[model samples]
Target: MRRTMTRLGTDTIRRLPKVLLHDHLDGGVRPATLLDLAAQAGYQGLPETDPERLRAWFTAPTSGDVVRTQEGHLARFTPVLDLLQTAPALSRVATECVQDLAEDGVVYAEVKVAPEQHTREGLTREQVVDAVLEGVRVGTAKARLFGRRIDVRLLLTAMRQAADSLEIADLAVRYRHDGVVGFDIAGPEAGYPPTRHISACEYIKRENFNLTLHAGEGFGLSSIWEAIQWCGADRLGQAVRIGDDIAVADDGSAKLGQLAAYVRDKRIPLELCPTSSVSTGAVRDISEHPVDVLRRLRFRVTVNTDNRLLDGTSMTGEFTRLVEAFDYGLDTLRWFTVNAMKSAFIGHDERLELIDGVIKPGYAGLSTEHVGAAFFRMEDSW
Candidate 1:
């Protein structure tokens, strides 16, 4: 049998109403910026001398959760973290990250970075938050200057293996109005569970602040279940493991386990990062990804670039991959984007404004009839 093609037209990917929910601050740093910052910080921990080689290095896998191809060795994310210790460096990287995402047509993004990881450079946690906030502020301004406005929010992540989940949660609450939208517990989802930081999560909840957990990426349904039941996360980062609870019958009927059913019925958002999942060995291939299955089951699934650098992907590249892998036509693309917008931490009023003012109008002007009459209802809702 012949193989099917998965490449989509560049125009279609660019025009989609894209919203990114799972990007990481440490993992999404630009390769060229990494070189410049490494030199400025006088850090000599890089694997390659030139930017291109270093770019290749970051994407290549090693003993970490991320995997690599044979010829191109993957670069460990440690060196990148080592270089991004100061506020200025963190700010610059965060600024450029937003610019890159905006160029790829992402209208909204929630960039997460572990503050504890940046403390080795002699800065306080508050200083690190300030630096990243400065970067997002500048980058958002830059996007507008280019005639495109992208809303960028910071989601602070506390490293599970490290101390200070409560400290970081406090930081998120402090900066909530100043561009920080929510709190997350990232790093090592296997041995470290969300319940470890139950107090911190509960504090965030009591304050009525937003929360999203990095569960089900490296683990399974139990991890996801705890995140929702115990931690009460508003969104799940890379909850692909929910697929384990979904059973497909020979007759093509799917049976969702209790956890999966609850998540779907409650409409809890799953921040699905296809390319990053593959890089980290969460899924063997894109076609086998449970995003489509969850979508068909009415699960609130959204697409994201978990780590743009490591995955060698953009929001456009991610959507293109899905289109090719599953023949996901324009309608599916719209659903993905719209779902992301709805699931964004932004308020319902602002989401309505974006849907009415930007997304609906933009897609309608595309005039692609293949998207069908569903577009009509989406537009009318706006």
Candidate 2:
């Protein structure tokens, strides 16, 4: 059965119901917000006082180096982290994150934040989580006033280099009923393996909490393997390196290695952020991103903006890039959205409700020509 195709434009892409699974809270703080917070807190560490210049600084590619290392990419977060020491700053950043995602048509998002990094100015870890949750509440309410219904949940992140993984895991479980939905370990993933936090991952599992590890981005297959086998990651944050296990022949057919086949067969979700993958030197460019190959292989692939401000990208921007590179239409876009909703840490009933009631209906409302045709194929695929 064939259906009439409507061209996917920027406006349509922006209006589609998107789900984001791997955005970073500190990395997404607006330049204007950072400047304002810096001034308020009397923090004079900002390189540029002007918001425009600061925005340029934050978004500019690191150096002219041929390859940007993960540590080099992470260095950009220092200034933003410096500004998020207080409750007000943390709250404002979180609220604005939701607002920005809503404007970009993100129906649901799991934003990751490292509370351990935010405790420098005397705030406890619990207080940091509380502040961010308060901001999410305010942002959700504000988005509703504009008729943008966005469900923003927190994934408390523990820096893999730090010794507070167990503490952060406990904090995530403590606030699971609040606004926090899952637990994660993020940071330089090379030397600091997910195994370092085995106790934390075990704790989260024992408590029946969700966990996602920043694996296979700067590292390789071993990182991905440990995250799944040893640490028991529910999802992989930037599992771009899994592509190493996938081979494409001269004729364009693809083959998955044992590990890749396991991931695909088990429906493990890969939070693939194309642009960020390039920025971190995980992939050469967007065209070479593993997301396209993984999606075509029927692996549970989800598109995300790892850092909106740092990468100068949004859900709309990410989808637009994919559409340009791969000529993806509404159907392909809906597949990614449904993949994310299906992989969400929320209750299965709520996940189905959003996918059937909110997401599919929202997309169906976009084009009169296709009506239900666009999603009908997706219903069976998922």
Whose TM-score is greatest here?
2
Query: Could you give the C-alpha RMSD of every candidate to the true structure, in order shown?
Result: 3.9, 1.6
Give Cα-based local distance difference scores for all models.
0.82, 0.89
| Deviating ranges (above 4 Å) for candidate 2 | 1-7, 369-375
lDDT of 1 by residue, 40-120 (tens): 878888888888888877676664444543212223677888888888898999889888888888888889978888888
Q: Give residue 280's lDDT in candidate 1 (0 to 100).
A: 73
What TM-score does structure 2 among the candidates reach?
Answer: 0.96
Best by lDDT: 2
Give stretches of model 1 more than 4 Å off. Answer: 1-7, 63-75, 369-382
Instruction: Give the TM-score of each candidate.
Output: 0.92, 0.96
- lDDT, candidate 2, equals 0.89
Worst 10-residue lDDT window, candidate 2 = 371-380
TM-score of 1: 0.92
Distance from true location, Cα of 188 in model 1, Å? 0.5
